[model samples]
Target chain A: MKRNKAVIAGIGQTEFSKNSGRSELQLSCEAIKLALDDAGLAPSDVDGFSTFTIDNNEDVDIIRSMGIETLRFSSRTPHGGGGSMATIAHGMAAVESGLCNTFVCLRAMNERSEARFGIAHMAPNSNNKGSGSGFLEWSMPFGAATPAAWTGIQAQRYMARYGLTNADFAPISVLQRKNAATNPLAWYYQKPITIEDHQSSRWIVEPVFRLLDCCQESDGGVALVITTEERARDLRQKPALIAHATQSIPFDTETVTNFYHKDLTVFDSGVQCAKEL
Target chain B: MTTNVKATIPANVPATMPRPQPLPGRDSAFFWDGAARGELMGQRCAACKLFRHPPRPMCPNCQSVEREEVRLSGRGTIHAFIHPVHPMIPMFDYPLTCVLVDLEEGIRIFSNLYECEKEDVRIGMPVEVFFVPTAGDKQVPVFRPARDAKAGSKGARS
Candidate 1:
């Protein structure tokens, strides 16, 4: 893991939307093509692929559709959004280890228009064998069905221990919306919220989370090109050097419905990951 | 809605959705069975003596396959609790409090907290487990504010 061994040459994404009116595979190909174009590389230049395990798009479909030449390496990391950064790490390792000359990392989703994870009735199917699936068995029977339901309890404990109220969280949402408002690509572009707005928002979980506190479900795709720093220097875009990339999964953690941990306030995995970094 | 109903649905809305069931595998059935029998069951490694929950086939510590079903003391303190209000489930009463409790046996359990006022629900508040009928006609462990516990005395356990 030598410093500056690998770098991100280009990044691209589809416009954020509630409905992309296209399949995830199409969105993935489009984003990847955009990334390749940005890097001044053709589809044939990509030799490796890295993405999330939960991503609906398949490597074979992408390779066939993009006409990529000589696919040599492919890997998918688990943990969905939590493992998102790991995709880049995988790509970096592929290129740095001399396994491949160029690698592409991607994530494409139809989160809103297709399947909604935030909906109460949309519990992860036990038969599907996916992340956070069986973990819901202990929870769903008790009416804790949604992600909000699973996360709300942990938020409550953290707030209570710190002597903080729900109002204390309003500023965070306000800041988030404020930042989004300034970004043209943001869903809430030009629409900043106030603390009063956050307070007035309907409660998703009483005394813990409001509607504003929750993340918006949207459909989109994003991809990145990773190659050796030496090769990246000649790319169209200025290369962003990768100093280090690592992922860690601590003991006693089960994805979002991680209720078994002794301490509800602390995310041991993040702490362990930071220590590794 | 009647005064005695645990959850409140909108007056005009029909409560049509069925609640999700555990569909427990062989390894985790003991826990659901213990709840049906008015007990909280946990798993302990027969070799290393370390306890695990949501039952697994093997112990991570010693890789021991031999394990025993241990009945845990239904006593614990509230580590965290939340009341869900949106995308309401018809089976559940509105303003329901779901709590994460740290058991006396050194494991945490996720169950709903009942018979407690919103203002009274706080972190480290002592609570005791009880069985409640939930979706799928399953008897699951829930919690209530412990009787005989002093109020305002935080039951913080590190």
Candidate 2:
């Protein structure tokens, strides 16, 4: 069957912050409404939804609250930020497959004030247990509790094998900050950092990084409305066409720490995704 | 009511209170113990004698359960490093330094290198362990440039 061809019709985001007064459900609804408005559509037009498992809101509750006409599809991806692009990938697939015409992809969290995902070792539960917990269990007892600590392992190894340094990572932060500065919706919007600033920042993990080199813990919501390309062209605003999308799991991949793998320096999953893109 | 009677309290306190748990299993116990002592430890197979971190009970190469705990020399070179611009979770405004160390024990350990100017942290610089304490009375072994080492050595490869 020919693919239906999907495109992003609208985008909406709440201000990023350490805390938001509203509940997670309220954040989800607000972003979804904004995206609908941007798309020149209504809650009644959305038939599908996709988000992450880490999100606290449920699909049924969201649909009921929004009064969506008919819920045709809904899904939750895993792996936190790694699933950012993957959520879009799934939405595009759902649209192209003719399973749903209007789909929404969203990430809503009060990472700082509510449930911080970056804490030193989260409790093991049904969703986070097994493979997820297994990977963490290996390091947490040894004091590698935080995500930075886990990534520090790979980051340090990468630095050792290559001729890279803390300065090299500064560029990455600078570029992202520059991009965020221009993006009014970004939490760090209007705030720019220099290499000197990055260097001067306090150390979070030694040799692997500094304070400015990390991402923020903001309480906000970001949403994208996806629909068929043919329909998107007829919409009020120009759509960012979905050129391609793919998700990947590298060989012998574990959640975050794949120490047992032959090569720990590179993120093979990301590399694979890049290749597909 | 004044009789000398022992009061029966609910025995649920032990169940409710959180207990100290080991991060690793029997196979990798040594790595955790070593970290508590501020030492970088890895597993070596009795057969092939290759070193591995996040220590496993069995050797990946030889599948030998007869493994030994080896103390790493803590001297290694940086393979790669990055300084994140955005604040990642639990690390607010914290700069990160990730390095791959080629241990003198013939094994490579990945850790954060610290205690110097972030600008001075070049790839291939010699580094040694600097243990940081944790909440559970355990210590984490981080790395930084060793004192009195040659300024710029070739970057270490995996």
Candidate 3:
């Protein structure tokens, strides 16, 4: 489908943190309200919503509390951080397909205070049965049980093949931190680290990564308002045009386990998405 | 011979009897076999003459099923590393290091470094393979310093 027709009219976010000090519904409303304000619109103008499946906030709850009228569309995307851009893509699709004229895509979570997703292992539970807990069952018994540990396999393989060092990965953290420092809304606002600091930081999964290299588990909500290019031009904020959007999955792919791929360093799905876009 | 003994052990401890699991699929069977033998194995494509890891059947370069299982030298230089402050699952309370190693055979392997201090690990340190066994008699290959290499040495630091 041709998808270059929609644009983001406004963007809003709540403070990122270990705790949000509010319910998921409240955080969602706050972000939606800010986004509507940024677009110079009211709650009554928003007719659609899109977010992540991991998100606890409900669209019905948001609509009821925010007094939003004429709810036409609402959906959710999966796949953790990979869903960030996918959420925007969904909003664009909704606008282009005439499912909703004015849509808001949001990602809000109390990832830190309530449930720290970074935790490596959860006790064997009913939800973890069958294929869901397969990888866990394989690695947990050997102490390679955390996300860092799982990802460390890829990192180690990449290093072994590329002659890369911890210093090479410093750039990723450095870039993110650099962007976060200037971002007033970021939890680590104005907090920048030096290469020396990264080197000196404590290790999390030896030889593969350190503490400073990881992204923070933030408790924040970010929302974006999308509309047709025509309406976007009439909106108050400068529209961030949606140039292109697509999602991809590679062959023999599993959630977080693509070990069979020839090159662990390069994510084929990401490469495919970039190429398709 | 060993299979017969293993088959009989289950009857003595029915509750603790381990199920006979199938071997990993074609793509990962080599890796699992290498781990069993305490060897780090990677795939080298005959078509393109390039080495790859997390072993797969077809060559990623040429999509050729004609490949060979080659044992890596197990010697590599640390390419990249990370220290995660917030503990990731399974391994908690201990500082973890994620090391990227450039294998001599032109493939990269990702694994943990053990039997060394976290502060002592440097970005470019030369390391060799070590194996840690897992359940079902599987061995997980890891790496560590090859010699008395200090963390701040010229070759060790980024």
Candidate 4:
């Protein structure tokens, strides 16, 4: 439907930390303030909200603090990690559909302090509202509890099919650490790891992942403001045009415990989603 | 206000330890029931003979709702497997080997693999299922290296 008609007018992020100490709502307000300032707009200009459902912060709560006059639309991407791009997709769709003039997409969390993904959640015992109630019900009883254990299934298959060794994944960690080390806002800023360090680090799951391969679980907020491309051009800075946005769920796809697929090695769904983007 | 319902717990589970029980009330009660009996079961499309694991109500192929139960051969190659070094959950031992066995029936199953060192495990390595009986007559499928994996080795496949 002639998509890409919307463009992101601003982006805002808070310093990443293992513990922000502040409440998630406070973090959400701070990021939203920065986003509005970056876009050369006030909170009053924000007419819609899009965010991570997994985020502890709520849009209405954030809006209450910002004193946003009205919200014409709001949404959250339901599935956790896989929904990042989809969050942007829904934001752009809001702009395209004329549902709202300014749509803000946000993801904020104190993952380590507030709710640790791998460490804290010992599910079925925790709650059933989480998507884990699906396939995880089968695996968790057997100790396949964390995301790494789940992804290890696919990662192992990928390494096997390609003859890739654990060392092969080290370069990726090294490169990311190098990049993060330079970004002052990153939790690992100015701290880089070597392949040696990555290799020696304890394994979270074997055959593919080590401690370094995993991302930092931190407390932070990141937000983007999207508006129609025509309106975006009049803003304070160059707009990041929504050239493309797409989400794909292929056959035999389960959110994370997607063990049943015939070809677990390749992210066929991700490849297709990227193609659409 | 404590009460008792021990039938939900597998027999072999230690009383002090909390075990992961499948969240029931789905279309696949038979699959778990079969696991309790040490058998592997899958759903077969009555129309196309296509097999599905963790049974579902509808057939993905041919859009047929009609289905029947079939017991699988429980033999497959190691499509991929992992050994978690840290063992996040207490139910498993550290250096745990979890496998995604690509069943000969063209379906896949997730389970633990045993009877081998971490280095000895390989993709495409042959394996067969065995049952680990748990509390209340429930059992979980686990794989071990196939005896005929090599020609004279017993793990051989055509």
Candidate with the greatest DockQ versus the true structure? 1
Q: Whose DockQ is higher: candidate 1's or candidate 2's?
A: 1
Global lDDT of each candidate = 0.79, 0.70, 0.69, 0.76
Q: After superposition, how far is residue B55 of candidate 3 from its true place, in Å?
A: 16
**TM-scores of all candidate predictions against the true structure:** 0.90, 0.68, 0.66, 0.89
Candidate that beats the other on DockQ, 3 or 4, i.e. the better one:
4
Ranked by TM-score, top first? 1, 4, 2, 3
Residues B73-120, candidate 4: write the lDDT tens digits. Answer: 888988778876654554454446788877888888888776777778
Q: Which ten contiguous residues of candidate 3 chain A have the minimum total lDDT?
A: A124-133
lDDT of 4: 0.76
Clashing pairs in 1: B7-B93
Which has the better lDDT: candidate 1, or candidate 2? 1
Model 1 spans > 4 angstroms off: A1-4, A122-124, A127-129, B1-18, B134-137, B147-158
Q: What DockQ results do all the predictions give, each relative to the true complex?
A: 0.63, 0.14, 0.15, 0.52
Q: What share of the true interface contacts does candidate 1 keep?
A: 0.85
Q: Write the per-residue lDDT of candidate 1 for residues A7-65, one digit (tens) a residue.
A: 99988888778988999999999999999999999999999998876678889999989
lDDT, candidate 2, B43-124, per-residue tens: 8888898776656677877788887778777777765455433233232113444455667676655555556555776666
lDDT tens string, model 4, A58-169? 6678888899998999886756697766888888888998899999888878887878776724555543545443666567656677778888888887886788888999
lDDT of 3 by residue, A107-164 (tens): 8778788756567544544124323424443344333545676677667667867887
Output the number of the TM-score-best candidate: 1
Q: Write the residue-wise lDDT of candidate 3 on B21-95 in tens digits.
A: 224555667876886788878878988988876556778668999887888778877765554444433222234
* Weakest 10 consecutive residues of candidate 2 chain B by summed lDDT: B1-10
- Among these predictions, the greatest lDDT belongs to 1
